[model samples]
Target: MARIGYARCSSEDQSLDVQIARLTEEECQPIRSEKMSGASRDGRTELAAILDFIREGDELVCLRADRLGRDTRDVLNIVHELDQRGAYLTVLDPHITTRGEAGRIVLTTLAMVAEMERRFIKERQKEGIAQAKAKGIYKGGTRRVDREKVLAMHRTGKGPAAIAKALGCSRMQVYRILDACEGAQTAA
Candidate 1:
């Protein structure tokens, strides 16, 4: 049986050092980590890789249940998948594991709490943005991509993929900009 570790963070700005250190302290081998939101299981390649390669009797370790997932259903699904593979999930913070019924119960409760905390965070963020707007100090989020440049590229008959490659942005971003420009023209 092996102890494998998985660490995750919501954004690129967040550090995974603490989680990695804790996992190392736990003697977990081949630790996998990623900088991605835990709100959902989508697009989490590292986590998916761990799940795919995990074998029976292997323990999946994380610093906390929230690191595994912020959504209750997603956490539960992960636990279920581990169970099916005869693997276990070990959470360090509350010291919960999926090796027993009690651990499963505690993990479930913690998962629910984590989901609630995520919702509360979103609500607080919305309230803060609203307050900022009321104070006339909210300039809105900074654009990571230049809309005019994207439009210029599109006007030059560049495809979404080509424009994205040239601008160093995702094809989705290029498509969204083009769609918005088209909508604006239709409205005008």
Candidate 2:
């Protein structure tokens, strides 16, 4: 049976080195990794590929249950899928494997805890933001797109797609800027 590994992180800024090292230490081969949020199963192409190609008797390994997913439903679904394929899931931290009924119960409990922890984190963040706003320190998130640059490009007869390409941003962002500018001019 093949022992495959999967590593994931929430954002590009986060490192996957530790997780990868742990998986390697466990003698896992062909480890797949991605820098994406585990809050949801969406946009996790590497994980999807693993599920798609995993064969019977193969085992999917991760550093922790949370590395597999933070959502309980998603994690349970993944485990179910693995079971259906005659494959197994091995989480390193708690050292749990889906090779037994007891392991599945513990995994389910851990998945629930992970989901709850995610909710707690979000709640804490919201409270922190509220406190910052109360102290007049919250100026909202920094803008990644340049409104002036978008307007300048549009004035030069550039289409939304062309402007987005030039600014290295999405066409929807370009459209939003253009729409806001148009609305402001109309009001004036």
Using all chains and alpha carbons, the TM-scores for the candidates as numbered come to 0.78, 0.77
Name the regions of candidate 2 deviating beyond 4 angstroms.
143-188
Q: CA lDDT of each candidate?
A: 0.90, 0.91
Residue pairs that clash (backbone atoms under 3 angstroms), model 1: none
> lDDT tens string, model 2, 1-188?
89999999886567889999999999999999986678999767789999999999999999999999999999999999999999999999989999999999999999999999999999999999999999999989778788999988888899988997787665666777888989999999
How far off is residue 91 in model 1, in Å? 0.4
Error at 110, model 2, angstroms: 0.4
The number of clashing residue pairs in model 1 is 0
List the pairs of residues colliding in candidate 2: none
Cα miss at 16, model 1 (Å)?
0.6
* 28-106 per-residue lDDT for model 1 (tens digits): 9999988768899887778999999999999999999999999999999999999999999999998998888999999
